[model samples]
Target: MKQQTKHSDARRPLMAADQSGQGARQDEDASKRSWGSEQLAAFEDRLRHLRLTPSQQSLASVVLDNPQQVAMSTIHALAGELGVNESTISRFTAALDLSGYAELRSVCRALANRYSGMLWRFMRADHGAEADSESGANRSQGDGKDLAGKNGTSGQRERRDILAAQDSSSIAASFARIDGVLWDEVVTRLGHAEHIAVIGLRQSQAVAAMFAYLLGLVRSQVSELSAGGARYLDALRDLGPHDCLFAIATQPCSKDTVNVAQWAKSHGVPVIALTDEVLGPLAELADQVLIAGTESDSVLSSMTAPVSMVQALANDVAAVDAAGTRAHLERQEALLKSFGAYADKDL
Candidate 1:
């Protein structure tokens, strides 16, 4: 049975898109920017999947309803409002993987910043805004220093430096979590699979399709799963031990995504999951799980690391069968030219 949140209708299609990449990619990227909304959706999913005590459920409702207020309130105040002891509040935070009230406040603040579209701006201004020496008013120190202190500290240059640092940290985190041997095994299997089906629901659709398109360029047995209806299950039914199901999902992961992965695993089909956190429902089901870093100080989380991983796998596959891969590309190019598939020389 598939589990769905009480607010599924509102969130299910928030990340869902049509088969076209040009339009879908735009929407997917936009959805990824709403980190606060995504957090609430994830909480809903957790509520559905995990058994919760009545007090915990009530506490969650209050937290979700007014996270900003919770951020301003002390533990004693919250406990008094809920008619619960302070120890109960402490236990609640622990259950949610938070350390204590302070950590809870930090999370709420971040989410509030996300909702207000001020996280990145606030962070940049925190360090970049300098008090005017004469007037004592706050002003951007655009000429203080550069990232390396060698160039002028223009606001644009400082922002670029901060974003670049974030990118570096995220890529490092991905590499740290990824197991080289496990990834190589997945790549080797993909190279030899008789058929390959890529599954990604909601925001992940764009990623899964991009992966399939890239693999298709090098080989001929790849297909992106459709979200139409029961037909998706039929596609899964057709898959066997010789086929591979590549799935991509991220935080606030969909329940339907987990269902398909579970089905494939139970049927003895190999499953590969690309996701953010190191441990989750999808990770438990996948034979090879790749963890990608989605952390960011800005509005949108970056997918550069995950996309790079997919590209690497495709490159390795091409390398494994160099002659065949070259022939495939040649045939594809010839067909494109013959059919006038490209718009112009620029294409």
Candidate 2:
């Protein structure tokens, strides 16, 4: 996942945020950059729900299934290629809410550009140009002649952009693998629990802390169990079938987290886990499992996707009982104001 662009120098992932358990966006969760094709998804949903004539269906597949070919073909050529009448092709585009074949072709062209390995090409072209420019400048400078640098920092920026794209894709892929049934089951279990204990260490500590904090705001009896002074063992002892254990662990899984999870599972305390692998140690012990990708360029792994999961869980639990949550938050706000723990924004 940490594919380096520069052969001469491997990426150090030397950023301070890597060690701080932060990212560039969403409160230092994931990379800050957005993918260009973020909103551009396949039209398979439209095809599934729409009814079409035989000729229209043929046209639909030709235009939407593989838009790259359609983008390069004229309307008449496309009609001929699909053995569909020109009128049928026009009708297909109309049904898709396009003005005509031109707009349809435009849409297809955009999709084709995105799916056609253009990102890799863009990086290669820019990187190669920068390398060539740098080489020429180096040779000239070695001969005691100075040459201006070209594309100064653009190549470096593109490298970071590619990594951001990779992180975005990983986040998307991780979310896509979620099981709807298990998600609802876990949400219900956590929302209705009597107590919730969160355990995380090393790379997973930030995620566990955030989940515990957010879950605590909407529901009491939520705690982050650390191993300091054997206190977590005391906390685990109180867990029972009525309570839930939320565990977070990734590569190089913490022994304490795993032991605590095993303890919970054996004691009949429902365990829910957020982890990086499908078959990790935490996953084995968890009653319910959620997966996220921690692959990153740095020596430190990423927790971006896990942070997103924490937000989703806390938010869903908050929504389980609207009235109770609202009252709880109101009381919490009053307590905070009374203690003057936070500065009053109105002042």
Candidate 3:
């Protein structure tokens, strides 16, 4: 079995933003946390357990809601946005036992990467050597024991456990990153849009088409943007303020989809993005972004989290107008029956 390397220590600090005297005027902590302990997941765990005053919690809320801003913005800019004094910001970091705002910002920067699709590079264990050794029948039930040691279960069982763990963790992480307010706003936009377009390309098309189909069952104007050549652009070109573009994009993200999303945003159309990254291109263009984790134990990325998000979004849209959705579904059911869409027999 191959050993996995711990690469957290090697992670480079994100480029620091320009600082000004107006940012913060406090001294650094004497017992500040080491940069090594500043890994994102651990930092988030600390955030969970750390007791906070009401003011600190409020400041934390602003950070939680806009991690990227905290990562990229100067302390002065952040203080201004939150309408809090620079000292209050310093106090908030102090409560977290951070050295100062600089350390806090570094953790935020790492977190932004984690919420985006890039964390797999940092989180996933090295499996390349194992992939080579385990080829064909030479691989026995020893792989799990390889990971869990000699006393552990067979390789097959261990593999199952690893995969299951990855799936569960990915799903939990996906839900954890969701901002309820953003979700509400997205659902509201979808409910009110005169036309809703779901655009996806390549691997993303499956989830996009599924979402569009589910949405169409309850709404009058929902479409999965066709890949039928230039006509896709024609469909996007027609969008306006009354319309919404619900884009489903995953890694290896489509340029066309990003362009269309940006184009719609410029045209006053609300764009809702269900994607894998927090700082992904689509997220940047989207008015509302819902993160869905794509990490997997295997080389190929998982769509489980993304699909679950879509299902939740569909249910929310249905809830927005329960009576109207019920009527529309009933009408569609009647039409399907009239057309004999389903066979009379089970066959």
Model 3 lDDT-worst window of ten: 1-10
lDDT of each: 0.65, 0.66, 0.67
Model 3: lDDT equals 0.67
Using TM-score, give the best candidate's number.
3
Clashes of 3: 2
* Per-residue lDDT of candidate 3, residues 217-288 (tens digit): 987789889767688788887888999998888875788899888888888998888887554678767877
Clash count for candidate 1 is 1
lDDT of 1 by residue, 1-347 (tens): 12111222322222222336754564445334334667756753453344446676556645543355455455655676667887777787788766465556555545544543244434333443221222222222223332222235575576576667767777776776556677678778889998999988876778888899999999988988877678788888799999999888875576888998998898899998888744457876788888776654444556777777787788888877888899999999999999988788665
The local lDDT score (0 to 100) that residue 336 gets in candidate 1 is 92
lDDT of 2 by residue, 1-347 (tens): 11112111112221211133332222222122222454334353454346777677556544443455465565555665668887887777778765556556566656555642334234323343343343222211112221222335874565455556656877887777777778888889888999999999977888899999999899888999986848998998889999999999976588889988998898899888888745457876677888887654322456888988889989999999889889889999999989989976899
Rank order by lDDT, top first?
A: 3, 2, 1
TM-score of each: 0.58, 0.55, 0.60
Candidates by TM-score, descending order: 3, 1, 2
At residue 189, give the lDDT of candidate 1: 86
How many pairs of residues collide in each model?
1, 1, 2
Any runs in candidate 2 off by more than 4 Å, and if so which?
1-156, 344-347
